[model samples]
Target: MSLPITKSRFCISYSISKFSRFFPNPSSLSSFYSQSPSVDVHDSQPPSDDVQDFVSQFHSMFHMRPVPPINQFQKILGSLAKMKHYSTTISLFKQMELKGIQSNLVILSIIINCLCELGQMRCSFSVLAKILRLGYHPDVIALNTLMRGLCRNSDVKKALTFHDKAVAQGFRFNEVTYGILINGLCKGGETEAAIKLLRIVEGGLCKCNVVMYSPIIDSLFKDNLAKEAYDLVTKMISNKIMPDACIYNIMIHALCKERRIKEAKNVLAVMVKTYVKPTCVTLNILMDWYSLVNEMKSAEHIFNTMTQLKVTPTIISYNIMISGLLKNKRVDEAMNIFQEMPKRNMVPDRVTYNILLDGLCKSGRISNVWDLIDEMHYRNQQPNVITYTCVIHAFCKNYHLDKAFELFKIMMKKGIQPSMHTWNIFIDGMCKGGRLQEAQKIFQYLLIKGYPLNVFCYSTMINGLCKEGLIDEALTLWSKMEDNGCLPDTVTFEIMIRALFEKDEIDKAETFLREMILRGLMT
Candidate 1:
């Protein structure tokens, strides 16, 4: 029997029972966590263990005692919220509904928050509607939660409009309300509007804080307004606010991207003078820029400097170094650094393996690829689509079609769905190997499966038919692809033109040449 009494009562109740031990009564709820829970309740997720314990306690208290007061349910919801157990919080809220506990702003706010976090904004608005129906205007916190939720879902324009109407209705706004709008605007690539909002803060509309300022400064830097960003930082400092490492790193990265390494170094010097310690991100960006500019010597100097400063290189740092080395064709040095990663207690992620695999494949070190594959399994890392694609591409490139097909089957059997790129690889490989019939079968399967047939897929198939002297079939496929709304690209047009020329169909080829010109697709 599910505690909430839904249709699948047995299944629901069994699910509730799993965490029933953590259910809290009014008597036990106050001292549950040593730290008093937050009221803001947005994204304050507790660790998994704490969450599990809270669940167990809630379940116990619910079944053992008479139903607690509504306030007690609110407290439990808040705690579940801090744990980010949103679904569980909603479930418990439904259970509260079943017990005849009337909804109050406190409980409704918690529900609204969970709905927002779950990206069910319509449901959150419905909860807001319920609060209004019960003659309770949502507090600023509740309203802010809704606005932030809209921002998170990338509905910044809607959030802006919502806030504007609320203000028109005489709902007073706070710093948090403004902050949410500013953050939303900056993230949505409307930094100009965000800067204008920050000016409102400067005019004493609201007190400025780091949270409101940081994103605008970062966005300014992103828009290549480095001087303006620095000017804003200066203003912040004038107001006795010190810039954090994140802001400094943004400046460093912007400078590096513009290849103004000297200016980036100047910013680093200022950071050093201010006693702001450089992070791995700071070092990695510098190293990445140096390597990209073919200045490996400078990159190595920074790598060595990190060791001297007692700052441990993160996996990202190592990955950057290895990638830089591989691009410079220093394969041996790349391998050595990869080997050193384990010594630093760093586990290699998929990117790390992919880089090494690419380098090995390019160098024709096929035997070493399997060794890395075995090591990936040992480390509990499953090879993803990119991993399989890399190996398949290598096999196809090396004329190992049988091996490529074998691996393709293995990936599918393991439930790794082949991406369009994967299909293209096999199709192109078959076409190159003069296996036109096999390529045609794969093309037919793609159509039957209703996978999006892109220009490359169509071009590859048409090219295969042309190679086999089947001009009529190729032309039919071309017409079919166009009818299916797959717009032909330059390569597709060129393929058809060449095929028509080969078959002495000069008039049809001229028509296509004119059509290509009309579409502005000719290179």
Candidate 2:
């Protein structure tokens, strides 16, 4: 094994000696040179700040008389790799190589690690070839890093083939080896294979941990195979391994999403029984689910229970409560909760402000928005594009186009770029207000800016044209919509069909209705 560089034997002296011939003031660094290098090959832990500082100084002396020791170069490169500065590490390694400094196996592995991180799997293979050419046996670390890269790139099949070859060659694999493969396969939608691999680990090929099993369980839940996921949980408990709160949270959220309230509560009970305390996120998930299904009473009860259990409600919890109340049109209750947020020492975020604005705007309380905007500014929560967009949408809804245009100007002055949603809102509003020429100008601008126009945009424009008794113009837009790869939805088809029939073009309406049925969008 390669050892750490010592104060007595660092090749830095040759560089300093060469530098001293040009400058008389090398004395300041003399005492620094006496200190030992901090990074050691045997220390498998991550690099410290001191090691990084040392590497910085080390790289600065690259042009000096003597090249750095290969072990020291490897240590710095490894540290850089660990810090996720993959490109910098690779560059340093190239400098080492150009100086004819022969890299050992450890340095070769670091190079592989860097290459893998950069997603340059092809280049990583070239390094492996060079390792073999140098007559250095490639170690498991190098192989594992390569597989990790492939997994990251979603090339699980190639990773598995390489892994199988290593196994056939009698290369011993560890938990990390299995973890990488299992996680990759699960993410790649090969959850069934991932579970089969997990069984192999359970069969004594390797030890299974939460890291290996969690992804599989999460995937199973996404696939709605909750029963199979629960089976794995039971097997895990039988193996004497306790699942983490995250695992239980996944199951709870999935069950709650499917409206299995009783089962979700049972899972929560199991979490409490297992001594895995439910986090604020867990309670928030339940609260959000109840709120979404319009079970306001149950949602309120859960929020109250959180306070009783001394689990402080998060901003998300408050947002959910306020938004839910507003969604149910209980604006007074939402405002009460909104005002209560400050007493809890949590300032309202942009979402909170937006929700309040949306409710106020819909209720024709546009005057209240200015005060809320002032409050947001006081809280240092600058309104983003969504905030401005919501307010602009309110103006459009109230038919105050000039005021909406004024706010749009202010938003631009604040350097906030309007999103595609903002453009869509403006176009829809103009179309509804019978400003067909203005709407057409915005639509043409959207096309010029390469905006991905949605079905709503197409439907709105076509509806506007048809309402203005311009049937030919609406048909031309429908053709362009299809040709530009924006598939018309049922609403789009409905608008066109209604327009064609209004113009007494029965054949086209019949043809489109048939097309809609064939596309399975209609029966």
Q: What is the C-alpha lDDT of each candidate?
A: 0.80, 0.80
Per-residue lDDT tens digits of candidate 2, residues 60-134? Answer: 757666765667777777767776766666666666665566779888888778778778776677677677678
The TM-score of predicted model 1 comes to 0.72
**Per-residue C-alpha lDDT of model 1 across residues 379-476, encoded as one tens digit per residue:** 98889888999888888888788888998998999999999999999999989987778889999999999999999999999998998889889889
Off by over 4 Å in 2: 1-55, 60-83, 96-108, 130-139, 279-284, 294-391, 403-423, 444-455, 462-523
Worst 10 residues of 2 by lDDT: 5-14
Error of 2 at 230 (Å): 2.2
Off by over 4 Å in 1: 1-50, 63-83, 89-114, 122-143, 157-174, 224-242, 307-313, 339-345, 447-452, 458-523
Q: Considering every candidate listed, which one attains the maximal TM-score?
A: 1
